[model samples]
Target: MGEVTEYVAGLHEPARSSIEGVFFIAREVVPDAEEGRSYGMPALRYAGKPLLAVMEAKAHIGLYPFSPAVIDAAADLLEGFDRTKGTVRFTPEHPLPEEAVRRLVSLRRDEIDAAIGRRRA
Candidate 1:
């Protein structure tokens, strides 16, 4: 199995399901994103840069968008969700909504695109 698949498979119920749901949203948002391990957790990359990562924590699942700006821009969508500078925390009982995941990925995609544009310019 691929690293992401293996990582997801290794997780127990609820966490496994939660991570899978995030993975599905990532695929939907960035069809070309490649899956692998980053920072010891399953992550997705686009255009050779980190897009998102998900890991099962002791009491919550963490979603990493790899950009504090993305988290800041998504404040509205993240209401009621516990978050740090770049990670959003949620419990299996209160997993992130698909729409919120979509917005987070979408914002991150835009950020990456902008960075690529800046580098090219």
Candidate 2:
């Protein structure tokens, strides 16, 4: 429990909650995942690399993944706001779709596995 995690966990509104909610969903999806603050933000990791990271932005909360392809795969749901290398902009006050988050997480893992296969190939 860090300052960032404490701050992020409180953003349970429509426009901002989704960012934290997605973080919640990701934490659950990863087996034996743990919570901590990294790089001045809330981070959830699996194995080693960060799986999900949440931070507050000027306009909205940023839900960032270690992999950018996951965000690309769920572009339909993302609907584009202020995005960066691996960050997706979302507000707690906006309606966050759970299914979309789930799909994105699941697909991201699949893509990761596929990428690993290519490397081994």
Best by lDDT: 1
For candidate 1, what is the TM-score?
A: 0.92
1-118: candidate 1 lDDT, tens digit per residue: 7778888988899789889989998999899999876777678988878899998889889999999999998889899999999899998899888889999998888888888983
- How far off is residue 72 in model 2, in Å? 1.1
RMSD of each: 2.5, 4.2
Q: Which stretches of candidate 1 lie over 4 Å from their true place?
A: 118-121
Highest TM-score: give the candidate number: 1
lDDT tens digits, residue span 33-108, model 2: 5676556666765444455676766677677666777887777876745566687776766644777677666666
Q: How many residue pairs clash in each candidate?
A: 0, 12
Quote model 2's TM-score. 0.69
Estimated TM-score per prediction? 0.92, 0.69
lDDT of 1: 0.88
